[model samples]
Target: MKRARGRGPLSTVVGIVLLALMLFPVYWMVNASLQPAGSTLRGGWFPLHPDFGGYAVALREQGRNLLTSLLVSLGSVVLGLGLAAPAAHALARFPLRGTRAVLLAVLVTQMVPGIVVADALYDAYAGLGLLDSYLGLVLADSTAGVPFAIIILHAFMRTIPGEIIEAARMDGAGRLRVFRSVVLPLSTNALVTAAVFTFLFSWSDFLFALTLTSTPSVRPITLGIYEYLGAHTDQWNAVMATSVLASLPAALLLVLSQRFVTAGATSGALR
Candidate 1:
């Protein structure tokens, strides 16, 4: 009993310390954003006084519309999830001769860096007149997310007993019907987890959004924040302010899906 009590306090202290370390940067970002411009230069990390003017500036700035970023992020999340779900379902349920090869290809894609293909993708988009468009960004972001989605959902589907699928087929249900009625319902955890990851990746993509897009009307928040920086100077307060604002949707998304994420992670590869 004495040893258990001692370990409890030690574990609690370690947990609190880790939490503080993880949250300090977020606290500082919010603190700096609330400070008056140029205050960070003199005051360093902590703000002398907190204000909302920085947020107002970030919101209403002519060439850095944060609203556009929010809309694009939301749209990307929806589109990517929509595309990923069907592909994941097909890959999980169907067994072609090259199915393993195709799955391996998807896994291999995660290894390729997005930056490496940016220039080539930019040139292709430019040729197709897709530069400075939300569709272009969404398509690029979707490709990045699809591979991981397939891998995740595939494992979850594999965990499901083959007997269930065989039973469904014996009942005269077609493959699509079986997927809709059985597999999809069972894999909601994986689907929700994939959506969370897709949203984060799409919202946080900076390189493709920066190089492929130039106009503020279509710029995502990641690139919108860059407008505050210059060739030789930077605005730390607005950058921090915009950064905080930009992070809200992603936070809200994860919070809403926390249950599914928890279930998905704890369940492991489906089974």
Candidate 2:
């Protein structure tokens, strides 16, 4: 047993090193955001004199875009979850004909390039007069969310014992009633996992935001960050600040949904 466990300390050190390497960029961004505007050239390595001006400028300029991102991400989450949950339940429990084929198709979608989807959406949106609209962006962003949510939820839902569902049905509960009342509540961890990822996917989406919205009227923070990078090349501080702000929702969600995420991963692996 001692020989078997001899690698544990080394493995832990390696894991900590890998984690720090992954998070180093975030630390750098926060550090740079605190530096005085144009001081990015000096490479201070630390914020000896932290400045709030960058954040102030970011808020003033990208505030509307931040709100737009929040709305679009939330809309994508609601729409994506609404569509994915029932489909996942059906796919998990029904054993319908061609179920494997359908699941294969959903898996195949994950392999398709986002650019192809964006191109198709742009053409369709132009014809439907959805170009540069909030609805258009939301629908486009859901492309990322729906398939992922379905897979995650389906994996988790499949592990839910069939006996419970049958018990609910034996009590005269309809399929819809059992799904709504019993399946949904029990699938809370999976749902939260799906919601968190869907939110993050939509929130960090730059391609759809770039393609679906032709005007600033519906621009998201991702696009705003892009434009900021281009227009404010000299103002790295503000750009970093905006990036930091854009990351807040994702960070907050990961922190708050830690338990659910852990449960989902374990359940998915077991299923």
Candidate 3:
């Protein structure tokens, strides 16, 4: 019908508008980063002649921390998912007494403010001589990231029926074997989703990294960006440029693994 056709076009226009609104800040950041300081802001909608100098400054001046941030994010994703997957598998298949309560406890732990635990964590890290270290940040980020990974992967694991697992067991596979063979393949989508989520959390975390790591040697890019801003307050161009650069890895990660996200969201909708 004409009405249906018109509705489809209108819906598409609305969706495109919404997407533009959401991406406007990113577009502006990229645009601003391409322009010389104050050039884009000097009464223009976009750069007259876009340049890559901001990106150059961001790389040469701040690339080291970007690498460190990538390491931190990737490390947290691998470690968090490693620890969470088995626990999620167990929680999904053999959920025990008080499991819901424990899940509630895990979710509740996430709600606690970072400031509330900062002092205690600082003291603990200092006692362990982990102050201003990557290990310390990794541990902190893992603690923060685990609960979400567990909840998310557990939900995805539940989407897989128990019969497949039981069949693996019947074929003389042990629990661990069954998990490796039957569950892991189907749950790759969840793993990617959890990794992406965990990476984002660890990548963007400022409070923990800033409080834990005192030096640029181990601090992630988020903290580096803050330091960049503090030291270059008058250099808004460099600051924005650094911010735009900082977001690239996560953006690339999402783009690269978007297929997993689609599969996980559609077929693995957590029960």
Best by lDDT: 2
Model 2, position 3, has a per-residue lDDT of 68
What's the ranking of the predictions by TM-score, best on top? 2, 3, 1
Candidates 1 and 2 compared by TM-score, better number: 2
Query: Candidate 1, overall lDDT?
Result: 0.78
Candidate 3 ranges beyond 4 A from true positions: 1-14, 38-40, 266-271
The predictions' CA RMSDs to the true structure, in order, are 2.8, 1.7, 2.3
Task: Choose 1 or 3, whichever is better by TM-score.
Answer: 3
Highest-TM-score candidate: 2
lDDT of 2 by residue, 1-271 (tens): 8965988988899999999999999999999999988857775889988998999999999999999999999999999999999999999999699988998999899999999999999999999999998899889999999999999999999999999999999999999999999999999999999999999999999999888887888999999998888899888899999999999988998999999999986797776
TM-score, cand. 1: 0.86
Report how far residue 206 has shifted in candidate 3, in Å: 0.6
lDDT per residue for candidate 3 within 1-271, as digits (tens), equals: 9999989989999999999999998888777777776544652468678767777778887889988888878889889989999999888889599888878997998999987777779989989999887778888888778998898888888889888888888889999898888898989988888888899989988888867888767878888887887776655566778888788888899999999977765665635
| Candidate 1 residue-wise lDDT, 1-271, digit = tens | 9999999999999999999999998998898888877746564565666778777766666225566665666677678767777777776666757878888998888888888778888999999999998888887787777777778777777777889999999999998898889988988998888878887888888888887898766887777666666521345666677788888888988899999988876665435
Residue-pair clashes, model 2:
0
Could you tell me how far off, in angstroms, the CA of residue 183 lies in candidate 1 after the best superposition?
2.3
Candidate 2, residue 178: Cα displacement in angstroms equals: 0.7
Off by over 4 Å in 1: 1-7, 41-49, 62-64, 166-172, 231-235, 268-270
